[model samples]
Target: MSKYHSFNSEKNIKYKLPNEITLFWNKGLFDSFIGIDKVNIHYAQFIQEQVECPTIVIVPGRCESYLKYQELSFDLYQQGYNIFIIDHRGQGLSGRMLLNVNKGYVTKFQDYVDDLRYFIENIVTPKSSEKPYLLAHSMGGTIATRFMQDSPNAIKAAVISSPMLGFYSGLLPKSIAKILVAIKLKFNNIISNTPWYFLGQKDYSPVNFTDNKLTHSIPRYQYFVDLYKKNKIIQLGGVTTHWLAQSIAAQKELFSKIVQLKTPILLLQASGDTVVCQQAQDDFCQQLHTLQPQSCPNGVPSNIDNAFHELFFETDDLRNKAITQSLAWFEQHT
Candidate 1:
């Protein structure tokens, strides 16, 4: 176990994964399902024996594996809900697409939706007749949104935290970033004949805690850092030009097809997020509200002040509040 697993009080915050949660994770069922193109999609589930409860399907963010969600799974299970998390293909424990395993690439964004559909139809529903709720984060939010649009009635309710409706172009304008991605993608097609990493993108490398932009809790961040270090197979590098292109195209489609969504979804915005564009999340809610008032309620996200990109992995205060709100939303529809 890493030193981060030990509870500590610092700066008026306490963070630790309890032994019982670890035991619960140890009992989890880790498995994989065949997705489109025969890509192996890894997933984890924690179901109470002979206990019927509404399931929570967790779609994680980009570069995330189901291993990173053990604490989260345990937390939700303790709340009387079964938890299910999937490691999207080309990342995590799932099958990689390119020979260079570090490079993140996807054939298309729809493949992600199709994989989730296959998983729910073949694996989740057959085991549990109750319709599952959705808890998707970051890039997973984007994939889950598309999934909801494609299969409107698939899930009961959804909680999308810091969704990747748009990318945060660091130090560059969004237009310039799109142009650069387009140029690089064209160059790769005409010259490289292989996927090229986006500018400044590289293989997985651990960054110092002080420099990370994902979360505010040092212990929580350190735990995942150590986890990736020990489990190199789940360490994924930065995005490829192809993956970025697919994501951009998917965002466009998501906005264009906003009216197709029927599942009720709660968009949780992180006020301090620098990973995805907050404006895009707002626009998505606004548009969704116009189409279906019941889906978004108002034209705005339930903002979590001072929270970072990874809401669930944030400090106890932020993480607990988000989970509580999500559970409340699930309970309402149940």
Candidate 2:
């Protein structure tokens, strides 16, 4: 384990390191030998105190870097849990899939799921003695649910933070969006590649803290902004039509399979969230509640009053509350 006494404590970053820790990142090429294509994937791990602890794998939201999660991981570590996080393809420090790194693009959603499975099977499962727990945020939550649907035994329990079970499609209805996407997919055949943006989406222009809907804590929010500013690899622009279509399809499929999920899961609903549909979360949790309550293979839902999409980056009180609630949920099913 890479031992660390502090996380640049002298510099006064958001949170100070509290334990002997190891931090390392894996920079690997996508070799067909492993069947991961040519895409490069970035992964980071944090081991705390050399203690016998259960592993917790975090899948961050779209356009997010694992570096944005350092404080949360530190808090989890203080509670005696090991950490592993992945920066998905086409985003973060991972290799970009398109000529325009700022534009989000993916051939299909299954590729993302496969990549996560590869990471778990090869990187996490062998190193840790305990079955890892999953904690997914936004798009990560969508991918995590899909992963659980296919491989339920991979993780002991999971906590989804404001998962994208449903999207805030805004003025566009589902029928219209699907029809538009179908048209774009058809256009793909005529053109080499379709470059249609999602409605009025644009490139990565830094949103001032006041206009941002992500988090309430300006300081914590700015901390990540600085990280993105330092590295263009961690920055992503507007969503493409293909990504929007894939997100809709993935969430639709995952919700359909909600009744069959045997994994113990908790859906953390953000009461003040505008990014994803809270009604969709309630719908899935309602179905999960039908199977079991406070038990394995059950989908439990909790609302964090006055919270936003980025619960982990919220105000200190709210952030700590989320971290505390998550630890409690993980322990319940562990």
Candidate 3:
């Protein structure tokens, strides 16, 4: 219900930075803090001048930095809301875990959840006493879910887009893929002290727009590609065997702990997503619905058709609807 949504995709498909968004980005605050194991975690924020407003805490996906969320943050800020985004460890401007910076790795999946807890308690709550709404995407969704379970009353509401509750197995069945990853991870641990990239995974490389499965809008996709081209610090590649193993273990724990969630949440499913399993999202919602039917309507995600993994960066037509729905969902809880 804000006019800022009209600026991005209404007139033309061409991606032009809006003057207001540019100004917003220019004046935004940037800072960092020491996370678990002394990792320096970077974050960005936009505070409204001389006005108290609701806050949105963005938990970005894997290989995503707060830098990639400029336009999205600007859009939400224009709606009179404060915006905060964190660049998680092993990616973004934050510290990397491996000697090879491009190899995605994490010592423990719970470290992400702990890092978020530190951000909320030490950073977000001090700035805004009001419980902030959570807007998490992909891998961030998994992190947010665990955080909510840990401190259920901390957030007023949440909107998770294309959550990575389950891995997508290309050729092998899910059970077989899990077994393979586990076996490879154990083999890797014995042979090498450091984590190795999963089979067929490599360093940072650009995919052609036509071949990319992230979004449909060429301009929107190009916008992010240009950012990565400009900054080598945030150019992250595929996951390591250890990272995949950690993620699988975390996913297994999530299902067992679903009954602990207390905050209201909305899961937005990308119907065409090949990055994460849709069946997993369905299973999560079905389990969550038995506990809180109002939070997840009818025990399933709110579907977005013709969308890829990156719902926020999708073509205007798709992205706008997803944003509108998320904003409305937050307003309901507020």
Candidate 4:
């Protein structure tokens, strides 16, 4: 009926119906597609068989892919919420490096917002036709926050886990960092060639760190390890100056009008998160309490203790607690 549909038909681009895993995981019934920028965008949806249930879209942090959130999807599915997830451009099984720049590097934060907007307009709404909920973690939280500010009525509610409002590291002054990144972006589109520091840690391997012991025992991590190992291009090493500048801009925008967001928000900050600054979380909640009383009526923010940056990947106790708190928040709001 639409020109895009005819174009897709001409290209033999038909939606591939998902299998049992899709139904069990509550993933939407579509596969990946190349977006307007010629970058591959992978997305999946889940639909309820009987009663219509609210949808929850899961957005992962940096260096994360759809495979990593299978557990989270399973949990949400059990809670009777359909789920949709997308692999950000250049990350996961999506398209690899563009313009010789590494995956996960973007010239502007709007790139992510655009990718999300496409997913929602083309995939989520068409499949579900219901108001969706957002569940974003870490770097994804930053992106989700910006999306909420940009499109207030796009979704009904949002749950942010250990959002990257600011990082815990006290490296360079914020002003100096912005200037350095701007110069790098001007010189070369590709910069910040250093590997992520956490990758060097012996125990930090995805194989060794899974929330589910039973699943982790079965060589599950090896699958992801092999995926990245075979496709070296998908391995986004570290953030570049341009990426940092984009992140700073997004953060500024998020903080500028966070209290004015009409969508109900559940900000989940990790007490033991060593990556994102906890003080920023406190400040954000305080501001929300003052400005948007309806969104956060109680004046007390919801927080979880003994959790780190990757709260979803924490040990069973912590991960379960995070999931419980998240579902409870969603139930309360939705």
TM-score of each: 0.94, 0.87, 0.97, 0.77
lDDT of 4 at 172: 68
| Winner of 3 and 4 under TM-score | 3
True-vs-predicted CA distance for residue 296, candidate 2, Å:
10
The 10-residue segment of model 2 with minimum total lDDT is 24-33
In terms of lDDT, model 3 sits at 0.91
Residues 265-288, model 1: lDDT tens digits: 899999999999998999999989
Clashing pairs in 3: none
Clashes of each: 0, 0, 0, 6
Ranking by TM-score: 3, 1, 2, 4
Best-matching candidate per lDDT = 3
lDDT by residue (tens digit), candidate 2, 201-289: 78887899999888888777777888788776689998888888888889888877865577788788889899998878888887777
How far residue 328's Cα lies from its native spot in candidate 1, in Å, is 1.0
Candidate 2 lDDT score at position 10: 18
Each prediction's Cα lDDT score?
0.87, 0.77, 0.91, 0.66
Q: In model 3, which runs have C-alpha deviations exceeding 4 angstroms?
A: 1-7, 10-16
Q: In model 1, what are the clashing residue pairs, if there are any?
A: none
For model 2, what is the error of residue 272's alpha carbon versus the real structure, in angstroms, after optimal superposition?
Answer: 1.2
Candidate 4 lDDT, tens digit per residue, 1-334?
1211111110121122124334565434658877747778887666677667788999878777776666567667767778888888757667754444343466467788788888877778776657888999888888888888878888878888888887554576756656665666665645345322221222123335445321212233344456566656456555655566677788888899775578777787767667777777777777877777755446544666666666665555666666777776677776
Clashes of 4: 6
Candidate 1 vs candidate 3, TM-score winner: 3
Give the 10-residue window scoring lowest on summed lDDT in candidate 3: 4-13
